[model samples]
Target: MSKVRVAVIGCGSISKHRHIPEYADNSNVELVAFVDPVIERAEEYAAKHGGKAYADYETMLAEVKPDAVSVCTPNYLHAPMSIAAANAGAHVLVEKPMAVTDEEAAAMNEAAAKNGVKLMVGHNQRLMPPHVKAKQILDSGVLGKVLTFRTSFGHPGPDGWSIDGAGSWFFRKNEAIMGAMGDLGVHKSDLIRYLLSDEVSEVAAFIATIDKPGDVDDNANVIVRMKSGAIGSLVASWTYYKGEDNSTVLWCEKGVMKIGTHPEDQVIVELRDGSVEKHKVGEISTNTKQLSSGIVDAFIDSIINDTVPAISGEEGRKSLKVILSAFESQATGQFIKVN
Candidate 1:
């Protein structure tokens, strides 16, 4: 079988940790180009993966003309890069948050639809084994009624991920519209939606610069009303010292499920029957990489077999709506409706 040709834009930590290795080692994909503004970085990436590299995404698009591209740039560039890739006749799998704004996300979605191509967002949290299992259990109705969930993702700061600690693009409000919430909080928001098989319709949030001392907020707490009348909460901070975990817990009338530790770990599902089911999955974790690969495989296979990906672009948009509304709620000091 001929593998689908893939070009990866923004050769950064994410692409390096997740997409690059997945593509390079996968038999169904051919990694053809690495795009990065930093020439040496691109070259280094290409060298490591045995693929060509380009300093410009446009140049790579025009030259390699890959079947698909992974837009792994910072928050600001997701829309433009995805739109450009779609225009160039390539399927686009954009990194999370989709875009800083709903307007940008809409434009990118429109562009992909206009080009008649697949447009997928990289919300890899949904692909985690525990999450997948949670969805299955939810669908099976074993949990009875879901009450709420507590989900959070936190770290010391952005020094490890961003190129320049507090001075990086993440710190720049203009370059990146929001901070920790948009970065880490959005993921949890999406996961909650995905796991519960519901949508967040209303959100009331509080955001502050409790740590890192900047205009961008480092910590946030949000109250959300899901479409199913399930009330939920999310808190994410980059200021947490001693490596706090990225964990999600779902509380139902009959049971509860928890994934990850304070900063990171396995998954545990507890049922009302006084039984516990533990599932531990790990393989190059990032933004929940197990879920990342699982969803990637599903997306690629769906394309090849003429099926639908478990998580569609529209599905992703639904999650984004909740995330954006949370931000609006924080800014307005009131509940923001998803509709």
Candidate 2:
């Protein structure tokens, strides 16, 4: 297909800021439909982006038959919506924490594979410019060996970003599954794996609903041990009242690599020789500043080229596994092995 017909399954903040805009910006994509339970929400985006709005996504899939669909709905709806789209012969670009359970994630992947369609997960951190450069540097073996690391993603809350604001599904335990961990911690789980190219062997965590008015946790602190024996802490919170903090610091044998930490520098590497290297690769997308996530471009390219998506369903599942283990750890008060 020269131009892939695209449909967005959610008209919320993510779809509004990232999926719809980025897909519309891509020359290879033709916006064909927008779906949302709230008819007005769907209609609003459809009017602006030139697509038929539908209150039901299954109906949209049947009617529009889009070449690709982005599942930007809540965590609970991700697996079903993606599977439905895939079964209808549409490629899928699903949001992170693809499913609430491993079985659901596996089923979504199975559906996409059975239908011969691509299933890309929206692990945008892996596509961020700074992260891409960091991966390149790590892969080059310039940094001797990673010994420990700390990665964090936090902001005031999703209250300001969600289309529904404070009433969004994000604060609902049934819809969102886990609050900050599902929303942000999963992103870091995927990023750590991508940059280090290693699987998490075990995890221990402390999860709490410190501030948010929800049954789900608003704060999570996870300790992970990678297969390569490197240890790290992953923090996800909705309590960073000051500002957003999406940063990662890796302590290697030869030096330390810090990502998204400095105000101006995207990456900073301090070597043991008393020398430092700073890189300004590009801006990382934040809750306040909506930058091109590069996820849309990659998804479209995969469709046009018939290549596997940069972040596939299995990759998403692996990341989800880490988060799942952390949850188990929180409940059991012991280190849980990542299966």
lDDT score at residue 94, model 1, on the 0-100 scale: 83
Tens digit per residue, CA lDDT, model 2, 168-224: 899998889889999999999999999999999999999999888878899999999
Against the true structure, candidate 2 has what lDDT? 0.93
What lDDT does the true structure give each of the candidates? 0.78, 0.93
Which parts of model 2 have CA positions greater than 4 angstroms off?
Answer: none
**Residue-by-residue lDDT tens digits, candidate 1, 213-244:** 65778888888888899887889898877756
Backbone collisions counted per model: 7, 0
Lowest summed lDDT across 10 adjacent residues in model 2 is found at 1-10
Best by lDDT: 2
Give the clashing pairs for model 1: 127-291, 128-291, 244-262, 244-263, 245-262, 245-263, 246-263
Alpha-carbon deviation at 230 in model 2, angstroms: 0.2
